[model samples]
Target chain A: MQNTSLSQANPTSEDTSKPRKARGPKWWIDFLVDLAGIYLFVVRFFKDLFRPPYEFKEVLNQCYIIGYKTLPLIAFTAYIGGIVFTRQSRPSLESFGAVSWLPSLVGVGIIRSLGPLIAGLIGAGKIASNIGAELGSMKVTEQIDAMEVSGTNPFTFLVITRVLACSLMLPILVIFTDILALLGGFTNVYFGEGVSFSLYFSQAFSTIEMEDIFASTLKSVLFGFSIGIIGCYKGFTSKKGTVGVGKAANSSVVMSMFMVFVIDLFTLQIMTFIRNILYS
Target chain B: MADTKSNFIKPLFDYEGRSRVVEIEGLNKSFGDNHVLKNISMELYEGENLVVLGRSGTGKSVLIKCIVGLLTPDSGKLEVFGQQIPGMKSYQMDAIRKKIGFSFQLSALYDSMTVRQNIEFPLKRNVHGLTQAEINQRVEEALDNVGLLYAIDLMPVELSGGMKKRVGIARTLILNPEIMLYDEPTSGLDPITAGEINELILQVQEQYHTSAIIITHDITCARMTGNRINFMYEGEFVLKGTFEELSHIDDYRIKPFFEYNEF
Candidate 1:
């Protein structure tokens, strides 16, 4: 009877009925969890970016996709935006006898804020959306997993190359947007206010500083990186199904544009503080 | 052939006698209280075409995932090429994965890349010191083997379903892997195309003589490609045998599956 009871107790002792405890929290728990996922993804991307058998071909492909392919849209919209923005601001300035200040006013506005912001917004629509949708579709179709199975790091191949391309390319695109906006501002001054080309040219540079142009251009780089990385991240980690792809693309542009403004506001504040200490 | 216990028992324990390449013992995986794989065990030898036949949700893909270290089993021991791999680092797994190839069901060809670029991707990813000429040669050879040499410059979108599958196979072949894992190589294709894919699989099997594990539901595909079949049902293998042995088995679920002639 004792032997039988012991045998029954041994089998029962090995029972799988005890509820599995939840994974507990610990020191560096959140850090470790977040590390291997998105944070590790970002680190791996940078590491692979500098490493060789560098996908120069894929980089060129991305340049075409993110920069060259979207040029027409960026150019056309920037031109129109410049024309409209100058014309719209003319009425408001004219009400206060600030009409003679048109060129400097427009120049300051373009270099300081409008130039980077508009280009980033348009890029948010064009580049970010494209990155998200493309990667989202890849994720949904198992193409990303296939890359892993084939011994190719998908993040290195797909995301890093794209992020690098956007980082390198968008600043150049912003430069183009600035040039077109200048042309458009000149055109608006000529057509809307009958100002001479020479007068508009001289007035535009009268008050503009090297710092203003430099700061805005630098900000666009951050804007571009944010857009590129965020877009790629959302798409790369997308779940669910076909609808998930669409959501990723949509969310990428929205979230990136939001972050761009947030960064811009903080940058402006920091720059103001630095300038106050240095020049004032 | 007689319905003997020895044939069934022989292959299950053949790991000791034969040169085993992949040995998975006592695999148990669960996703938040829902058990996906329960005590799954199998051994694959060199140059053997092993097919895992199962219903849709029997963790067939999960099993292959464990082999490749894509999904960690909750409890198990999996050895690949004599390296114990349960909680191995990704870099270590990457070293091991260099000798493995996986062809997905959707083909998973990078749509952003052209056919030539897709095939060249693996060579570019794996080999660093090779010259442009050597890379080009390998890419051409792989594309030629898959019969897609002409479509090199065309985008993945331009290719047909069969052509995409061939490109996918070409990409896998670029790595010259020692083991190949095929996930439903032929599911949605028309019969003729499916047969062509099977022929391609057979051609690869003959030429490379690498160990292959095919996870599929189609009996016709299994019979055409697999040298040995393992019937996976309810998180475990219900029966495992050659096509002839499984056909002769006197069981309910196993009977119609093996004997039914869809071909």
Candidate 2:
């Protein structure tokens, strides 16, 4: 009994005093634990999603937050990217005496790859980090536990709504980004080469195949889902105290950005494979 | 020696005739290599306040958390309302959770929501058929009970520490739970505010006829709110008695808790 009380009084000593066998590397153990946690989280999300009493109001509110609130930033980045890419490529095209291809060049670059990638990275930085911080603070404050005790499913109310909103809205944001980029490109072209609006748009749309639009939209949707899930998972598993919130937010952004790149790589490979099969 | 000591203490504080709302026998819980709870046993009867007095990190909070299904015991029996909590499914635990209100140490009010919204949240989720008017009435009544009716429209961030505790209590009481679990309910408050909270706890227990397991080190709170007191040390109840009975005991292990000079 005295030994038990002494052990309880100083837990660190008890832990260190015992000689225990190694259980693999610490990092590998942590990775496995994190992977299992994410798996459980995904399973819980789907379970709640298929169950009755869907949270439509919460989903719409999240859409308004994750989509409508993010338009300005997306528009700004797209516009800047379009102008810069057009300006940089114009000189080379002129040197090759193929300045007429400038519009199509910028269009394909912006629509097929740059637009979705940029939007996803932006969402990862903004929405993913924001959700992570928000939910991390909730966890620290026990608000999530309060929700659970109140008979409100925190997984459904917090995780599902945010995940669904991001997945559904990122594609829309990417489309909007593409449109803004094209408009910026057209503006630059009209001024630089004295091309008419009709001519510039025609050149741009001429090279944009149906496959390009489909693939880009698909990438955005997947990126959105990854960002949302990673953020929620990080925040949900955050440790106690204020520092945990900061760590959650930072890790969420980092992981989401990493996932975006990975997803983009696989998507491009899949798209190239399909194109080859169809046109070979 | 330990067995004989516990046997000598156990019969002196027996609560046999009353209906037990929560019962635990030989419960154990551990975190990594640290055993937080070991061979713990207690019973919370209907409409009684069981104050668990313990030093920091003595597993008092873990004990109540186990009762409320937040933390699973490593082994042994833990039954609440005759249902074993450890083996219960998520939905089943949630069903049981509706009857148990846990007031967290930090109040745990949703910062994004106003007090009215926080109070209304449980009613809207738990009581499906309640109309807006009925929900509003209940929210107001809960707020009124806590004497914070005016703070209803204000957000949790705008609330003071004492006010947040009151709002937490109001939110917990809104559902009229059969069991209330208060984890350090008055830990960080001023003495006056802590007294008010303790009084409010007693009032709620009496008014709602709910059994409560309040985990705290506050002697004033223990004296005011507890119908019976259980002093926990090293994950086991060292002594169980009324405040007056336990305070008068000459055991050195229990002496510091009653000694007023330290505070």
Candidate 3:
């Protein structure tokens, strides 16, 4: 009796995303449910990961989109990061009359942390939000259900492919960021101190080892995975209507960025643990 | 009130002889504390368009979604082809889903793909063992059936609202589903466009011999497409009969629905 018009094709019959006023006892329940939901989502991802007539074409397409389409931004940001870091550090090094150490310092910084973090943060914002919004739109429009009814396992085709693309492409993007950043550092140092390109690179790389590169690559892969999974989860579970799509996109960006930093902290500890065992 | 409750609507035509392809008894669904569906029971007879008419928020869409296993019911005896749908795993449901074609209200076409790609989707995934040429031929035929063969190359965004619905039908028909679930087929459409869609629904029921459960509030569509009608309110059927039987009901619950179509 409240209204007479139809719901205009919204799934779930009613708008389930409408806020409930009282949350006194519901807070803990909500938190636990969300956590459990994420856990099951991850489980589904892994379960579908191994058993599949793999969506190779979609995976490749996602790689090209995630990697190739994102190259310009990654490259530009890393180059700027290298320039700014070098510009700021030059004066400090010069005051101590130890400017000779600048190249080595720049190399370590870029390879060990800066490149991976930049790639992850940018991927979280760009890639994860896109995944969230795209899938969220699909969810609201019932494209995911359509896929299911059409006999395509949506988790396998959509979720697995995007996540795999992210993992595969992140390492590659991190490498590009690392190389661009160094080239940017070289440009700055070469102009400021008149250092030759070859000599600058040689000094820069002198202090870096295989461990630094391996750690950075690991972080990149983990960042990619986190970005993909969080985005997919938000999108796949989005309810209500177009409003839910917007929320999904916004939360995906925030959560994936948070996850990127979390992975960074853990990876740093992991790297230290390995170093102690290896170097000892 | 007691007299009216005792006089609940019944079928004027004998559909008991028809085999029920979809059967529901005391079906219930809830989202948190909001119980959307409550003790609902219905049956979709083979090759008949069973329209469940209800205003927004009456759990009409939820019912169809439950039928197709897209949404699980909280408690119910919901079945398609007499197989219980609620507890069936997704893969197991896929076998059943191949026989059900669900044409979404918004068409739900893959926007990134062309119309031809959308039509080919169910065929490429569900109806395996077909060659590329066979797929192409079938896609063309499906499009031809919907009178949109020229739009095969166009993206979903480029097509008009009616065209999108037609393409959606083409896609589902490519699978030749035994049961078609049309969720608000004419909800957001103009009367003329809605009439075309209603005609298409009837044509599908005739040509493909599909048993359809059309969830709509459009009385015109309900009249045109439905073999029998059930008017739902607050998660339960308030009235149900053939259009002939329902149009004459003087009850307040049923008056507004048939009032518009009255001569």
The best candidate in terms of DockQ:
2
lDDT tens digits by residue: candidate 1, B127-214: 7889999999999998899888999999988988888888888888898988989888887888798888888888898897778999
| Ranking of models by DockQ | 2, 3, 1
Regarding TM-score, does 2 or 3 come out ahead? 2
- As for candidate 1, its clashing pairs are none
Give the candidates in order of lDDT, highest first. 3, 2, 1
The TM-scores that each candidate's chain B achieves against the reference are: 0.92, 0.93, 0.94
- Per-residue lDDT tens digits for candidate 2, residues B1-263, read 03233323332233556688999998989887778887787778877898998888889989887887778899999999999999899889989999999999999999888999889888887888988998899999999999999998999989899999999989988888999999999998999999999999999988998999999998889888997788887677777766776776777666887786355
Candidate 3 residue-wise lDDT at B224:
89
Who wins the TM-score comparison?
2
Single out the weakest 10-residue window by summed lDDT for candidate 2 chain A.
A1-10
> How many residue pairs clash in each candidate at the backbone level?
0, 0, 0
Q: Quote fnat for model 3.
A: 0.27
**TM-scores of chain A, one for each prediction:** 0.83, 0.89, 0.89
Best model per lDDT: 3
Task: Return the TM-score for each candidate structure.
Answer: 0.88, 0.92, 0.92
